[model samples]
Target: MDNVQKSMNLMGLAQRSGNLISGEAIVLNAVRSRQAKIVILASDASENTKKQFLNKCEHYSIPVRVDFDRNEISNAIGKIRTVAAITDGGFARSLQKLQ
Candidate 1:
């Protein structure tokens, strides 16, 4: 599989391993509290969402990735979500390496 596919698969693993947080509110909280190692924003997300997350991530000095669409992210995590946070540093590092 390609790196994108591998990344998606790793997201699923992260979720299963309880190292990921999904949904807007939870992710926002995680980011603000510095609990999120990295945030992934769906490419198809709304402008407001992109702006908000980009601003928050920028202010907090957290890494963000917008490589996947909503469908890809939702499919990987088995949930309909536009945003997600990898809370574990190890998982975040692995995903970054894949990117």
Candidate 2:
């Protein structure tokens, strides 16, 4: 599969298993709690949201990706307004290939 497809697939798996954090508050919580293995921010995410997530990720030494737009990210993660933080390692690895 292509990078986008791969990301979507991994995201689907995450969603099915209840491993997803789809909202801003939950994402921020995950980041602050340091439970995130990797942080994926939508390219079109607002500057403030992006900055917050990136800053947290950097503070925690977590890796980050901005490869896809909001639609692509939301589609992949199976949400409409997802804007920040954290995913399972497999998804993280798949996204890493795109980077």
Candidate 3:
């Protein structure tokens, strides 16, 4: 599989391993509390959502990735979500490397 596919698969693993947090409210809380090692924002997210997350991530000095669209991300996690946070540093770095 290509790197993108691998990344999506890895996201599934992360979720199953309880290392990923999804949904806007939960992710926002995770980012605010510095519990998130990295944040992934769906590329097709609304402009306001993109701006809010990008700015919040920038403020917190947390890494952010804008790669997969909402469908791809939701498919990987088995939920209809546009945002998610990786709490494990190792998984965060792995996702970053895949990009």
Candidate 4:
């Protein structure tokens, strides 16, 4: 499969395994607490939202991927969110590998 499809499949796995978290506030909290190993933000997000997430992830030393759109992400994780984070390092690394 293509990298994007693989990444989305992995996200589904992460969600099923309880290693992924979603929503803006919850994801920001996870980043602040260092629980978020990697963050995935929708590429189509508003510039303000994008800036906020990018800045926070940078400050926290967490990796961020801004490739997929909100629908793609929500479909992968089965949640209607524009932002999500992988809490498990293994899952995070797996996602990073797709980049």
Candidate 5:
């Protein structure tokens, strides 16, 4: 699969394994808690949200991807939110190239 398709599939796998956390705050919290393996932010996310998330990710050395738009990301993860974090092991490597 392509990058976008792989991301969507990985998101589905995360959801099935209950390793997905949606929304900025929850995802940020997961990152702060050192539970997040990778963070995915919508391309259309608000500037402040994006900036803050990026800053935190940088501070914590977490990998992040900004490939999909809000609708696409939300659709892929089955949420309306603009951000989501995967907390499962090995998931980060799957998204590394996108970071």
Candidate 6:
């Protein structure tokens, strides 16, 4: 399978394992708590939203990925989310490897 498919499957696994958090408020909270190992923002997200997340992630010293668009991310985790966070180190490492 392609890298994109692999990444999406991994996201599903993460969600099933309850290690992925999505949505703005939840993800921000996770970042603040240092529970989020990686933050992913949809590449097609609005400029303002993108800026806000980028700044917040930067301030928290959290890693961020903006490789996928809204649809791709939403479909991957079976949620309509423009932002998501991987809380587990193993999942985060696996996802990063797909980049």
List lDDT for all candidates, in order: 0.97, 0.73, 0.97, 0.97, 0.84, 0.93
**lDDT (tens digit, per residue) of candidate 4 on 4-93:** 999999999999999999999999999999999999999999899999999999999999999999999999999888999999999999
For model 6, the local distance difference test gives 0.93
Lowest summed lDDT across 10 adjacent residues in model 2 is found at: 82-91
**Candidate 5 lDDT, 1-99, residue by residue in tens:** 677787788887777789888987799999898899888898899899999999999999888888888988777778798999989867767667544
Alpha carbon lDDT at 31, candidate 2: 77
8: Cα error in model 5, Å: 0.9
Better of 3 and 5 by TM-score: 3
Per-residue lDDT of candidate 6, residues 22-79 (tens digit): 9999998998999999998999999998999899889999999998899999999999
Which window of ten consecutive residues has the lowest lDDT sum in model 1? 1-10
Worst 10 residues of 5 by lDDT: 90-99
Model 5: lDDT equals: 0.84
Model 2 CA deviation exceeding 4 Å by range: none
Which parts of model 3 are misplaced by more than 4 Å? none
Model 5: what TM-score?
Answer: 0.90
Which digits, one per residue and each the tens of the lDDT, describe model 1 over residues 24-96? Answer: 9999999999999999999999999999999999999999999999999999999999999999999999999
Candidate 6 deviant stretches above 4 angstroms: none
What lDDT does model 2 reach? 0.73
- The TM-scores of all predictions, comma-separated, are 0.98, 0.83, 0.98, 0.98, 0.90, 0.95
Superior candidate under lDDT, 1 versus 4: 1
